[model samples]
Target: MADHAEHTEQDKREKLKELVKDARIGMLTTMTTDGKHVSRPMALQDVEFDGDLWFFTYADSDLVAQIRANPQVNVSFSDAKQHAWTSVSGSAVQTDDRAKAEELWNPLLKAWFPDGLETPNLTLVKVHADSAEYWESAHSSKVVTLLGYAKAAVTGKTPDAGENETVRL
Candidate 1:
């Protein structure tokens, strides 16, 4: 039983990485000076999850100011097709690290920054993730998940819907 539990925990950790591996966009929520929370869709740079999340944005963007005022932020990703979702809570800081920016740069970003790496006001925002929570269906297939719901409906018992785990960095 102990071995099983250990494997389960390891699997959960790997699941978090798998879910975010293909997730290119995440909703970044920041607190404004007026104590209001605002969210914007931001493209995530580097699919690797190593306790930090990186994003590129204009230095003049309101989010940069919001992060300066309040570093606490939330970044969330969802994939409806796979019924997986993740929420990451962290503190963010904006920096003008040109070398880091060049390393994470992608040609697709040219759509936003016409001048590419030389774009003026371009900066990097790094979020030091404190914790992350993710949920995903436990069943191997949607058909199996649906059957679980149907069984619960007939038996009047709760369905084995999925697994949810929280990881602390």
Candidate 2:
């Protein structure tokens, strides 16, 4: 296993990217006006992370209003097959950056925005992630991990599940 101290900023960013690359969907949590937290699934826009996450939404969405009220948010991704999970904390803002929209655009998004890029109220939420924490199991296979767990159970010792680290951007 690799030591946490050995990972540089670039290494951490790469690791985080690797963990969440396959997780196209993530839950975005935002604070409401009443101080309550609301979470909804958002498609992770296909773009180089670079310490930021992007999502497509409507300009009039409650999410946009909430983000305007409080920029602090959290986005979480999980991949059961890999036994990996990641949570990113950041500040978000709504924008209509056409260039960025074009960069991250995919045809599948047409299902949401019926008129494609011309869809009225179409907007993007850019999340400037401050940090991310992730957990990943050492063994990717369920059978292998179960066996390891069984071995630990029989031996009454802790199982070496995996590595977990928090990376600051």
Candidate 3:
């Protein structure tokens, strides 16, 4: 039973990585002090998912302040063409590790930080994922989906929703 649980965990992690591999952006949702949910599109950094995700932001950004007050956050990814979507729940922390910042830094970030890593207020946000839920449709092709909908409409039956699972990280 223990072995099976471990295998399941590994399988979930692999599936998550595969789902987000090609996604370039994710909606990062955070809670504000007034108890309002704010979501913004964040560029997904180019890194392997290993129970943690990283992003570069400004120290003075609202996102950083919000995380400082409330660490809980959700990052969501979707791929319309592939009919895949995932929502990752985690806690975020601000880090000042220069080495890590350098490692994850890329040329594209220069637009936001003109001075590169040396840019003032530059900071890293690390999200340690606790769990995630993903939905993947079996009929990924457009034609198949249309056909499924058509069949469902004609038969007055619910359309096949495909697979959905929640995994603990």
Candidate 4:
């Protein structure tokens, strides 16, 4: 039983990484000083997930300011076709590490900053994940989901929604 629990956590962490890797764009939600949640789509910096997520943004951006004011934040990723989704809750910190930025930098990001790493106001936002919860449907196909719904309707049973698990980083 103990082994099973440990394996489950290991599996969840691996699954979270896979999901995030495929869905590079995540909705980063930050809290406003007035207590309102503001979410914006941010491109995930290319890096291996190890309980931390990095993103490139302008130092003077509203998001950077918000994180400085309130470190708590949430990042959510979704792969609709795979029926996989993950929500990560963490504390965000803004860093101006040129070496790290240069390592993660690529031509695609040049669209946002023509000057690349030298672009003024370019900064990296790091999210230190405290915990993450993910949901993955056993049946990834839309057809399978529809069949499950139809079967449930005919048999008066609840459809199998999927699997949900929370793991602490």
Clashes of each: 0, 0, 0, 0
> What TM-score does each of the candidates earn?
0.86, 0.91, 0.89, 0.90
lDDT per residue (tens digit) for residues 1-169 in model 3:
0233444767878888888766668898999999999999888775455668788899999999999999999999998977989999999999998999888888998998999999999999998889998888878697898899899999999888677777788
| lDDT for 79 (candidate 2) | 91
Candidate 4 lDDT tens digits, 34-66: 999999999998535567999999999999999
- Top lDDT model: 2
The per-residue C-alpha lDDT of model 4 at residue 21 equals 79
Better of 1 and 2 by lDDT: 2
Which wins on lDDT, candidate 3 or candidate 4?
4
161: Cα error in model 1, Å: 1.9
lDDT score at residue 104, model 2, on the 0-100 scale: 88
Model 4 residue 144 CA deviation in Å: 1.4
Clashing residue pairs for model 2? none
Candidate number with the higher TM-score (1 or 4): 4
Note the Cα lDDT for every prediction shown.
Answer: 0.85, 0.91, 0.85, 0.88
lDDT value for model 3: 0.85
What are the RMSDs of all candidates, in order? Answer: 2.7, 1.7, 3.6, 2.6
